[model samples]
Target chain A: MQRLIVWSLAGLILVPAAWAGGDKKNGNDKVFKIEGTLAKDDPADKLRKNPHKVHEYKMKAGANYVIDMITKNAQELDPYLRLEDSAGKNLAEDDDGGGFPNARIIFKAPKDDTYRIIATAFKGVGDYTLTVRVASEAQSILEQLKESLGTKQKELFKQFPAAKTEEARQKITDRFYELTADSLLPLSEFAQKYADDPAAKEAKNMVRNNLRQLEQSDSPGVGKVLRTLREKGPKEMHGQVSLALSQNLRSQYERSYQRKDKDAGKLLKEIEDLLKHVGENHADLASQVKDVQFTLKNLTVGRPAMEIEAEDLDTKTFKLSDYRGKVVVIDFWGHW
Target chain B: MYPHERSLVKRLENSPFALIGVNSDQDREKLKKTLEDEKITWRSFWNGPKGTGGPISAAWHVQSWPTIYVLDGDGVIRYRNVRGEAMDRAVDELLKELEAKKK
Candidate 1:
């Protein structure tokens, strides 16, 4: 039987936790390294959504800490993390904040107390490496913003499936844009005030992440949001913003072509102009610019299908052009 | 997908149409069994042992499975990822165009 373990981490809970064991010291900073496994027989959380393991740690008041749950195979062990007060109150939680399938939580202790850290698998089961360390003040603020964004994004994703009507879906999408804008507006201000700060790169990344979501959702407010970000956001991020806009426009062009819309060529021209601007201004994105132009020139509707010459299951080689006289459906398929 | 493809191939058996698959199954022997069991009668090019990461998919920049591209008799790409009823309609419309051109 095939092991269908690999799956997209999109919409999956991305979080992390640590164990009480293996406390190590790195200078004045207390470093804790915990290795653990989540199995099928593990206890599920209160909501019974995920199987988890819990650990307790003594935390100092007003101190910032960064916790990460790193798994060897993200496809098998999608880690989630939660920090709770001694009284079991949820302080903060994260999923995919450490990057897809891994989890990280940045927490500032409210008071001197023992805090419970919960390690769980969002899906599947495997081993993970959990580490905890004191975070610098600057890193903590940025990471906290990311954690909060992750939490809200998680909540919105949960509500997405239950949204039956188009109106409800649109409302949720609008809320996503609002949340993203709320988080970014402050960062944008900070970036402008401290123009030379290295944090601007991080700010750019946040914008890129939100733009990615916007592309997938195709929200009606996307154009307005993109305009606002381009005008108000850090100049360092303009390249990614342009790239995302061109990509979104490419999708629109494809859809228009599929529908046989008369105005499809207009969108193509817009995309071409956008890419040209990116190419001249964003030198780093030159290769990507070339790739987009190549696809536009060769792979668009009404273009000749690119020839594929490869061996079949029987080891007999054939060319796609061999079946030129027939109407063909080329399916890129996998059993899993 | 197999069932629908089977039906489409059968429905248009007499027409100048073909359904070609770039299959990303890792195990070729297992895929052969699946092909037989699923009664898949169309031609498929193997995407090699690396499965989805193989050369064909990389060249095509195909990010998802079951990504369909419909091409006309002149080998011009006409539609993409149109499935089920829409897939049938796209194919039928192209075949009709071919018929119209013959006249």
Candidate 2:
């Protein structure tokens, strides 16, 4: 069974690489195409430092467009796609949105104007096919939502790399959540309505991810959304949604309990019942269920910090318990 | 962050406060140079060759860089992921509490 699992996992990893060579359809709406090559030693501009090709296209206001830059023949080339208005204001930029290393941008044109589409290789030299098309009318709702959410996501991705401090990164992230706070209901509705659409899977993921972040930041919308999802979300989502809702409650209970709120006990009961329900009904998420339970019982605030004994920079032993009577800060830090 | 941390370490030099690190630099030798150049005086546990995926961070279930857990004098965790001024306040409060107990 273990060997079978390993092979299957390997197959899953290889699938996207295989698709790199295969022709991909940009949904069913064709508008225009540009084929270009980016070579090393090409002039670097203020907009993009990488070797790139630029094309200009006129876009209509309120129209949704799907832009894909897929590398041809060269698997080593990782394409980065960007869309900017004529004045060089960045509208949307993407890396790896078109599967493994390709780039896709779902953009909703804000005005009727000439837009510049810049195609560049993030790594290697390659010939790439850039396809621009209308986001099909049949999938208009999902496309519209994606374009709206994608803009903020693109901005975050663009700024995140240059963020020097944790505070700056948190500011960008908090802005994203603030911008998309109202998206949970609309996205959840989309996921439920289009249960079988490939994009629906993404929608569900966005909801889950946003919920997890909301829980962490203790956002006000978290409780309302969790309760709504638990009470009325799609049946297939019940298992995971219940788990998310329980986690939301657990965090709230932790806070209120810390403050000695009278409602803390009642909230704890609700959390326990929801967790038990998830465990009993969601066999597929068994491990995740156990993780939530473990965190609740062991890793919560006021619990004794877990002990650590390890080698320091010089291979000498270092232990957390050694500084027993001192207030300590364990910083899990890294530099890349 | 390093400059801020340097000042923080200096300020808390005489207090019962220790800021420990689990360093996730892939190259230990390079990190040794950085420690000296950056003037990092605190001791740091090596996170091994796997860097961010090393044993210590993996065991702590840390998903992001610079995950922080502030523990009180008795080694009970009191705060998490607090940074900058918030981290300073947490450490000060705990230190003050410890001093009161000593009296």
Candidate 3:
């Protein structure tokens, strides 16, 4: 059973890489699967508190379909979610983005058509699993993803040779853990890939010794920027300030989890306060702050639902719930 | 991705794609300067009490900077995790489907 489980896990990781290479459709477009999980299994490791994702799928016209999504917990914080067809019109939509730990948003697919799924987390921490399956459409993206992964893996080995040095090897191996240490099997598989390599073995030991360090590793290069903010305030590099702030908090949270510190709660509070403080003054940054807060709230354990109220530029007053019947996608963001 | 994600902001200013920007520069004057200098024409939404991120940030569940979601007319969620070429392709693809369905 253990070996079986290991094989299955290996398949999951290798499959995606395979599809990245061959298995191109008629259009030669790359395919990907929706299986597996994006968050840590412990539940404590998630800090999603923002709304920002646009999922799109193409389908044959006039087909019956359903979009399946899994939310880890239950909440009443409904965001606006919608589905629009290729012609720039809504086929089906709702005002609530919540109500989905594993939800199916059903719709009728027009002939030879494609659709986009739009949703905003109007209130709460966001740890969600989204899956789309249009049974009637002959084209299943999930199946395609699986097929693609099979082919891509072979190509990866062909083009990408093994790391040449301990430093170079450590980079890939370190990156793997730094990005996915919370993932038990992923960490294990990547380690096994280079089991024979001495550098890989050393790197794996380092990763094991500091597995928990993954959480603290959010700041790849922002440590200096974060310290600068602490000492000098937001006077310089204001644009990067927000990014550094998020990274700083992420690293701090990781550290707290590692040390089992008594100041965990206080640190979290300070981070929130700092975010709020940043939002209070930076009108443009305020949205970014809110979004980060929302993500933290959603993916955090034992958290309250978020409540958001916004005025649509065209409408008089728009409460997130008001768009309940339609799919509402709130882009509570802008780019620099 | 490599351009706005790779090249420089100046390149983005000259691209043909339409952009709706949210400036994070603390200084309004600086923000305005960047926009004017770059020849930006899209709408700008300032982060406010009800802006995208805030205590309400938890409300939207925004995990990172520069997030976007699309909804149907009745406000059902349709798509997410989009940016760069994926966003443009997805939007164009959806619009095409919507038009065909209507016809």
Candidate 4:
């Protein structure tokens, strides 16, 4: 049994590498194709019995790529795709994001590194044709913004620790906001033009989410800049900016509770006031705000670890509280 | 991370320390095979087939992968989100407190 298992696993690992090598050898290939069928004993099949396959590609930093996995027969197979960095951090995952029963992901590579594209079936296993296409214009613009914003953010953070006076810190904060708004203007314009493109939409959403998170900074100038962006910047992003501001306020309220800040009550009241302005169209954001409120009621540090009962590989039941006499470390993880 | 965790589990095997895992893998057979292949003797709780949305992770509100939590002997969460040497130091201190209490 042990020998059989080792041989089977070795074959599984080697076959993909051999296929990838064959693709590279076929001249300068712009699009690479992977053809595979998931079987009952295949690793992908074992991962939920849906057949999951992993392909690796050497991707350049700042390059935008669209990955598509379409099954030959839509009636028999539905494809799911996930892109992960070298460290197994998931960049994106999609099911039915393309034409029905197919998968598509538009991603801008964060760094020049090897990335894994994981293809799987939602139900039954079948053959899939996976292709990677480069989007040149999108890639070029994304790369520029990524480089400039990264440098500016790094320079600002470096100065933040050394600034001794409130005025000096405020100046730094204002510059950081100015850099953000200036850099985001072009991308926002691109998104406005290419409203239907997933890559553009995703890029726009990322900037909005990041700006929302930045609203948590203690610098007073940060809020002023955010208000300026909302009032005077692109009209298309106004609703998004308002929602982000609400999220930022919600985050601040949560932090106050965690830090036992004296202004926790005031922050909570502010969050309530901000929520009123968050339009009804943002049901998702409203639900998230409620979730945060729920989290505030529970899940505080120093509280007793929540009681849990789960089965081990041996199918034996165990309770978390059963190990009360021993110090415990709980690791939440997935093999994939 | 797994290698360091394995060694830590072995080092504290005979002590009043337990390393419980809440695994989010969907397949039981694969997990069993991985455990045997990796020579992992520590017991791990199977979170369920839904991966991240598994009952345990959902109940605990785990926002990220490999979220580690350290609990004192009394089951109160003392430290969290610490890994590597920081995790080692925190666990060592907690064990000493447990030992001192026993005395």
Candidate 5:
């Protein structure tokens, strides 16, 4: 035969280009660029040292990658990113996106093999610069802008309860802040032009955490589109959008001090002017706004009950002023 | 919450009400097997194993998670975060204002 049919069509095109050149010479899907330095003896540095720098790759299935880390000591680390896979589940995670304290993860490989990437430090640590790329057309424009922003957020939540009026709910809250800034300003200009693509900083921090949960709605046009995205958003998400607008103005000052709502001291001076724009380097949100100003001055509702000793399961010690005359009802609870 | 405070502690077992619990569960045999499988006849307390800064939800500034208050018989706090049946109508209007201040 003609030389064994040209050597069986060159052994079926050299066996898939010698199995894709032996997975590009054994570096599986390649493109890593790791660099580390967390410290305090690595392994999740005990107590509060926060350290967890792991990395591994392989991936392939449908390709696309993007995992970035970066960190030029943004006020002592603070980065955090997680991926996991080889059975350890969790597929993606990030904190402070690549702003403030860097971390990113723009995945795709739903199958093919190994994954794991950890890199931690939500407080402080040091050096970093992870990076991984592959990025197929910025992961098909972030899966077509996350399937057209989940079909325009389910058609703006079905036109938000038929906008019954307040000028048709402020024109459906200005068309939900113009469909969340036309679906996150083109994924924040494709993550500032692939700023070392951690899936375009995870699709621009998932469109700024879904526009900070629609600016924690209490509606007036989502509080005037969160006061115009706190005067034009993205300064590394102004301290997580002013700590979610000071926890939605301390849950509307505890629902206007539990319905005695004559705007309870104007919602406690608008929660002390949103905890003075939450600054004092957020000492745990200024000790949770000084424990909500000591539970609005000693646990509200006509204050007074503040004692509580605790210890019963037969281990004695009681008190809450030992149920004085009686009509107590404390609760507090938890068995799980 | 423990079946509406175990049926308002058996409908205020003979009045002058009390129901104080606190608990935080750092596993004292799983809070004594959930206060003996939830029969929980009042008297609780515990709040340790560092939950909410232990020592009684950091001395009363408990910022939510089952925080329920309601004191009255001169103790003071009059209904903090009422619940089910508005916490049985604020303990039947503070046990009818401590039975009209004991006559």
Candidate 6:
């Protein structure tokens, strides 16, 4: 009995706790070290609604810091970094709309406080190796930091001007043809850096937040893609979109058939057909709709999976059974 | 909080925002540390009054960590699902009544 309890405890909580525990630096710098699978990929791992991977760390005020994320599992990761105090008011955040598994991030920590270095990723990547280094105020800025941010920020600023109409927005958005959303941060960095100055921080945050939202947006890029296919895409773009989500992503968009697209009637029909054909088709676009449905359906945090309960480190049991009658939103996620 | 909530939090400086923190998550210490680090002295919790005595899990049918619900003084649930910045907007709108009551 003792051995069983020990082993179970280790598997469920101890091991992951060990990995979450940070490695202390002797004097100045702080690094957040996560070394193993925190949760053995839950069946709902891919179904993660909010993909913002948050990391928390403590750094000396006014000290230079570097944060790096080197991933091993999900390769399609585009990561954005941020620093926040406990109050949830963002002290510093990068709208870089970016990535790096082995990226070397550099910044200065505010004086005399414990701040969290949040690591946010886009795309579906695997395991990760994140390194954050803190340097004395005396250390010089790295080459990347010293490089001219002004020119780059201006270029991105001009290129990413607010879209007047959804159509106009679509035109610029096409340039972001990423298969899984990892490398979209250059603009994000520009926005945050110039937030307080002449540049519009609200607009910048909008874009960064939009990208994050789009990653979790269940509306699927399908509707927009469908519109483009007929007007700008291959002659038979309709059939292709149908095949992509149903065949590859493992999902179906049935209600879409009721909706009319000036371009692809047959394609919409095909999508419905695919869903009907497979009682439970897990379409790729299902990811996009997950957030939509999660929000629209009003799901809460504890009620979705009431039956599955895991034991914590302390000798106590948690049963989802207790929260059955209340609204529950299920969330499977990680943070620093 | 998301954009909508950002607006609401701004309105509630004098009003109370029932910002309860549930830390019976995979990272309790981190959550506690987060509040302290951010200097957010908002009233938070570790799974209700069980207070580390046990894992007071989805008892209220919570599906997310940092999940929040607003119940009026009358013992009725005024709002159910709230989160991110939108959640801020939600509780803020409700707290507006408190401000009005004062007037």
Per-residue lDDT of model 2, residues A1-336, tens digit only: 999999999999766654552234322233577778888876663465788778887677787788899999656688888889999998888889888789998887899777899888777887889888776543568877866787877888799989998779877866665556457778888887787766787788888787666656443356666667667776777777677777766766766755768987898778777788889998998999888877776566656878899999899997999988999988888766
lDDT of 5 by residue, A107-210 (tens): 87878887878888777788988877666677767876776777876787798798775568657665665566456546766777777855676777787686
DockQ of 2: 0.67
Clashes of 3: 109
Q: Give the distance in Å from residue B73's predicted Cα in candidate 1 to where it truly belongs.
A: 3.1
- After superposition, the stretches of candidate 1 with alpha carbons farther than 4 Å from their true spots are A1-82, A87-104, A107-202, A212-224, B26-30, B99-103
Q: State each candidate's chain A TM-score.
A: 0.58, 0.70, 0.26, 0.42, 0.28, 0.30
**Pairwise lDDT winner, candidates 3 and 6:** 3
Model 2 residue A136 CA deviation (Å) reads 2.5
Residue lDDT tens for model 1, A278-305: 9999999999888878877776676798
Tell me which of candidates 2 and 4 scores higher on DockQ.
2
Candidate 6 lDDT over A289-320, as tens digits, reads 44333332232211122243544323255543
Q: Candidate 3's error at A108, in angstroms?
A: 62
Give the B-chain TM-score of model 6. Answer: 0.56
Off by over 4 Å in 4: A1-206, A212-284, A299-304, B14-16, B61-63, B73-79, B93-103
Stretches of model 2 off by over 4 angstroms after superposition: A1-61, A67-95, A103-105, A109-133, A146-181, A196-202, A246-254, A257-272, A313-318, A334-336, B26-39
The Cα error of candidate 1 at residue B77, in Å, is 2.2
The clash number for model 1 is 9
Q: Estimate each model's TM-score.
A: 0.66, 0.71, 0.27, 0.47, 0.27, 0.27
Residue B9 miss distance in model 1 (angstroms): 2.1
lDDT of every model, 2 decimals:
0.79, 0.79, 0.46, 0.73, 0.70, 0.42
lDDT of 6 by residue, B1-103 (tens): 3233335445554454433334453555555565555554433334433433335443443445444554432223344444565455545554565456568
Give the total clashing residue pairs for model 2: 0
Give the CA lDDT, 0 to 100, for residue A103 in model 5: 77
DockQ rank order? 2, 1, 4, 5, 3, 6
DockQ winner? 2
- What docking class should model 3 receive? incorrect
Q: Model 2, B1-103: lDDT tens per residue?
A: 7887888899999999999999999898888778888899988899999998899887787888888888889988778788898899989988998999999
Better TM-score candidate (2, 4):
2
